[model samples]
Target: MSALRRLSLSGLATATAIAGVGVSTAESAPPPEPARISDVQQAARAIQGMTLEEKVGQLFVLFAYGPDAHKPDTRNTTLYGVPTPAEVVAKYKPGGWIYFNGRGNVESPTQLATYSNQLQTAAINTGLHVPMMIATDQEQGVVVRIGPPATQFGGNMAHGATRNTADARTAAAITGRELKAMGIRQDYAPVADVNVNALNPVIGVRSFSSDPQLVSDMTVAQVQGYQRDAGIMATAKHFPGHGDTRDDSHTALPTINHTLEQWNTIDAPPFKAAIKAGIDSIMTAHIVVPSLDPSGDPATLSKPILTGVLRQQLGFKGLIITDGLEMAAVRQQYGDAEVAVRAIEAGVDQLLLPPAPDVQFNAVLDAVRSGRISEQRINESLLRILLMKLKNGVLFTPFVDPAKVATTVGTPASLATAQTIVDKSVTLVKNNANVVPLNADPRKILVTGWGVSTTQALAASLTKRGATTTVAQTGAAPSDAAIADAVAKAQLNDVTVVITQKAWDTTVTDKLAKQQKLVKDLLATGKTVIVVAVRDPYDIAYFDAAPTYLATYGYAAVSMESLAKVIYGETKPTGKLPVDIPVAGQPDTALYPFGHGLTW
Candidate 1:
């Protein structure tokens, strides 16, 4: 029997107990009840009741925005080759429509709800009478697709730091409330991938934690928050784990080297837990785990990983989705329309944002007509999809206006909540002689760095504080001339603060060498030089002469302004380093060890 069947048997007993429906003592226990028919199944049943073209139409999910919004094509037509939703409904009725950027200059909850209502109205006009699934990447924190910075929710690392499952759940509840208010039914969130690699470029703060158990625990809370509290379908993403890989699947295909045994122990635990917790959906990663599939294909296209492990071993009965097929990792490698056919056959129920909609749709349609793909396989996937919609209460419903979009999306209350969380997450990494809380007057201050001057938004915030700040723009490596100029200005000032903005890959290497020279020159003049590392704390390792070094983990405007307040003693440096920064590649020999922080 499939693992799903066994799991369903357990769920049946639990449901029966909850409902207080007892077994009769007169006869053998009744045959096991089937698992609840999900909305995906309901939608599939409705489609099965339709004609062949309508069934094929139900399989295609069109982009909300036109193809031109993504990339230009040779034929000057959008790559999807499918007409707009209004056009498509006029001709061939599609099953569902997925939205990207909608009709708003700025995406607030109010605007999203307005656009979502319009989109649903268009879909309903197709005469299918099905309310389409409106989806968005409301992952929260740095990757938020909706809400403003002040009102946005915190990322996984912040939740990990709090170590409060309730808070995590509350955050997901907030995300769901906002999305549901905007008429969005599906949320691609609660990143289930454990962040084992600190160097992972893309999925850094997006992950809950480096520990698998912690990730599992928090993921359960988030899933519950979104599903039970907010009543939206929650999706656990990049299944089979995308945490350990170094290469970003957005740019190129990444490979994980875990053995089957290792994957079972390390990577598969969270997904297993999420399944047990009753998550509604799972999104496959574009990563190749050689141990699971020796052919080195992305898990989205791998039968062993998707069907064998996710379906059979992990026993996930929810909808299975593939990552965007437009990503370079899939596009560069699998250039044929047949790959989409293979992905569906391999076990993925939904092809997310495929690059070529017409080609992909035609390929799946052709496979169905021919014997390459079975009708049962297509029915199985469609049933799962419909069942999910039914579970979310979307299958047989008409379009309903979102009731709470404006009040919850970017309200002052939400912004205040975000600020409270951000305040707690700031970690103070180093303080030697308590040299902070600069005693010098604000009238004579000189600030030099990359973002200090160029980013006008940040500079304006500083100017409001009644400080005369001169910002010097320099290349990755500031020339000796720039350093000399900064030193001269510092010698004339009572306090000199160097605000260095570090890029993601640590680009200011050669420029940092020159910055070090400038620091030594200013220090020789007996001037107090405060070096504030605005990106990563590790940049402090390069400077030896600066007496006061501060790290503000991110370069966001709020973070920069907060760091300034801490340096001036307006607020105490209460944050401790979230990640370890080793000195000379030795944890023990670290300059400023992890968990190091001071308040003045």
Candidate 2:
């Protein structure tokens, strides 16, 4: 802290201080050896004295859940009459924690700091005094887990829509700064995946652009901004690229058929740039690339890709983290314990959110005891883990002031920065027939549904814009019959706004049929049918004949509000298509390419 402070002070003392830390200092006024050594040097000395159990503990990063965010993997069992995840920290003393749920079940900022501090206090109680790294997958707008009190920046696809790298940088800086202030020093973000595949289920708006160069440039800028501006470690993720695969790895194993050349040209540039830019961590994708490893193993468990490509070929010396091993991608085949051992053998430095953390930890421990995994391998990962803690300032600054949380989170400056990104990223993809800048009255506007919650979310945003918005009369679930009813109500409105959302890339026959029916019926009435895509922009390809089309790239509150504001001509739509939306004739390319957007 003093080193950073002194560097800011303008004086000859800077040179004096520099000379003091030099290899051979002046004999007359040699700097006293009373202070501490560098984070790297300190980490090196600390590891030598650690026990094998303690060292192995640092290899795992497990999830700690808030009440409302509990999933199948979260520990639901109570401990000491408390429903909190406090017991998990005490039992494992793992190297890190993944904080889910920034909304319900999470207390106010001050209480959140207290909870984090309490966890840290329990972790260091083992006498090793090691600090645990707290992290989140705060990938901006769409995948934001931390709620109010945190500025939700417009996501990566939004950044790409603006074609502005600085927007990406500033949003990341704000996110990282606030996260750090709340005791989280790491974020898994700035998705390096180039969303080249129009039907990519997982990497849609979370990715920056279809163009590799644009993704690479924006990725590097995001890393720099997060680390330099806010002093937090930003991880470049889904490495070896999870962009082109059609399957969602959360439920299935996705495959990328691209050869090494294709991977190098399209998928590898961002990882290379991230490495060169001093990114602290790199996350492995669970997808399979047969060209990289013919055994059909996913990249997370493939030695050739993890060791040969990422570490040896790419020259990334930082920590290598695996995507959540609990996902069906790896879990369906390899049991909890077995895959954990394989992941370590694959050259991964950390196992992220392994299902059954105890089972996985014990599996690796047994592997070491049986000589199946060597102590040397353990040392290599241990060294990286310890160094990361030190270099990222998690070692000395283990605790944060609970009272100061209010001043750091969701400040006016951060929210303003977020609104700027939103304002710039709400894109107008197609406005044929001048349907947008919808009539100033906007008194009788009908919003059709896909997902009821998302429909209501967009309706709320429209309502804020002084539009009399009504959710269509769709049944419990979106179906052809339900959409038929919705179309009947939509025809009564002065203008109908149909908001579409798509997630899974496969088996959408029913959805496609319903959407076609809904739009056809509404258009038959001769009322203006305005299509606003709240999710992936590619859904536009299914209904290209709609008189007007727009892409918000997300359905978040900010994204919806931006979409509504643009419709009212209150905020100019500046965002362009981050990915190509193919028309009827053009098969593989975008009808609207990158850097194409409009305003009325």
Candidate 3:
């Protein structure tokens, strides 16, 4: 054991004894040295010295239950029979931990930092003494895990509209700085997928742009900001691209029929740029790309795609992590254990969030012992993992000072930067009614829309701007009563602002049809109507009848305030359309072409 770890353990035992608890002989044993190899050769030597179980353990990044690392939660048990996150870490010895807000893994910045420190302490107590790769999908906008006191910046599409690489870089740097402050070392962000399909269900506002060059530039900038500027390992995700799929991998296995030429031209450029910029990791998509792999397997389990295309053809040298293993797309063909083995066989360096960590870990361990998976293959992944840990400061600084988390995470400067991006990225798509830049005299405005909280936020912003605002709550699909109430409210207001939210690029739903009906109904009132798409820009294509329209690409606090400013002429719209808005029900025709924005 290193002297520092031994001293820490000694102090712990002494404290326990002082509390009248006896110290066992097990507590007296020296712990292992910290995993802090500075070079690849040193990492290789450390890997060589590791036991087979320890080496296999380095391949998985599992999720455990409970908010506090040390607090036992019998209600939510892992497959390994562990009750606490620290126990899970000690028992499984996995490479890392992936946190999810839905899983009750995150609450606030200081609490999360404390949780991380506890886990790191548990990891050090184990035989490997390796620091973990603590990660979370803080993708900002819609896919955020940590919320509130953490500055809520707009997502990729919001940055895409700004058409500024510097904005992307600044956003990523701020995200990285905040995450790192909370002891999170890996961020699955700056999605590099080129969104070409208008009907893509999942990658709509999460993607930077439809144009490959724009996506490439933004991806490179984010990669540099996260990795170089903030010292966070940025992961360029959904590799081999998930932007063209009609189905979401979380529910179904989507198939992309991009020809090799088309894939190289459209989807490959952003990933190429990310690789050139030295992105630390790439995440594999669950979608099947026939052009890259003739076999019907998704990219997560296809050797030809993960090994041949990504590793050899594209020459990517970073860690290749599989998307969440619990997703239905990858689980459709094989059981959990078999899926884990196949992922290892397919050149995946890290298996993310296996539903059954123990079963998956043993499967890979048995594969090595049975000669199905060569130990050299395991060594190759371990070396890469260790190198990443070394480069990203996970090995050197595994724990964060919880006291500093609050000051570092959501500073005034970071919030200002986020607001600036939103202010610059709010696109005024149409102003034929000239209803925007509301008159100097206070006007009674009605705010109603799809998301209740988002619409309420907009109303609050408008209210702050000295407008007489009345808000009517609306659901994802407005009910008849909601529509009636909104219309009644609109009758009292001089101008009605409707906020529409649709994150998916899929076919128009019955809910969307009802939303369209609501907008048309509001327009029929003959009062000045302003339609603002707070989530997806394509929402305008569904109801183009509204004479005054705008697109904010997100509904974050900064975004809503910026939208209010644009509406009141306090901020001029400078954003261009990052992705083309296809005509309703017609993906081929453009209602608003890319880079289309009107400034008054």
Regarding TM-score, does 1 or 3 come out ahead? 3
Task: Report the number of the highest-lDDT candidate.
Answer: 3
**lDDT scores for all predictions?**
0.65, 0.76, 0.84
- Rate residue 515 of model 1 by lDDT: 56
| Tens digit per residue, CA lDDT, model 2, 1-600 | 123212112121232242221112123342333235675555556667776777788888876656322122223353112344656665666788777774233565565566666666556554555668888788986787777777876788888888898888988898888887677888998799988887787888899988899999999989998888889999999988999977899999999999888999999999999999999999999999999999888999999999999999999999899999879998866888999999999999988987777688889999999999998899899889877876776765666766667788999887877877888888888888998886567478888856576678778877877778788735223676677777778767887888776622335666656665666677777888888777787766666677788888776767776777888888788887877776634547667777778886
Error of 1 at 474 (Å): 6.5
Measured over all alpha carbons after superposition, the RMSD of each candidate to the real structure, in angstroms, is 9.2, 6.9, 3.7
Please report, as a residue range, the 10-residue window in candidate 2 with the lowest summed lDDT: 4-13
Candidate 2 lands at a TM-score of 0.88
Worst 10 residues of 1 by lDDT: 1-10
* Candidate 1 vs candidate 3, lDDT winner: 3
RMSD of 1: 9.2
TM-score of each: 0.78, 0.88, 0.94
Ranking of candidates on TM-score, top first: 3, 2, 1
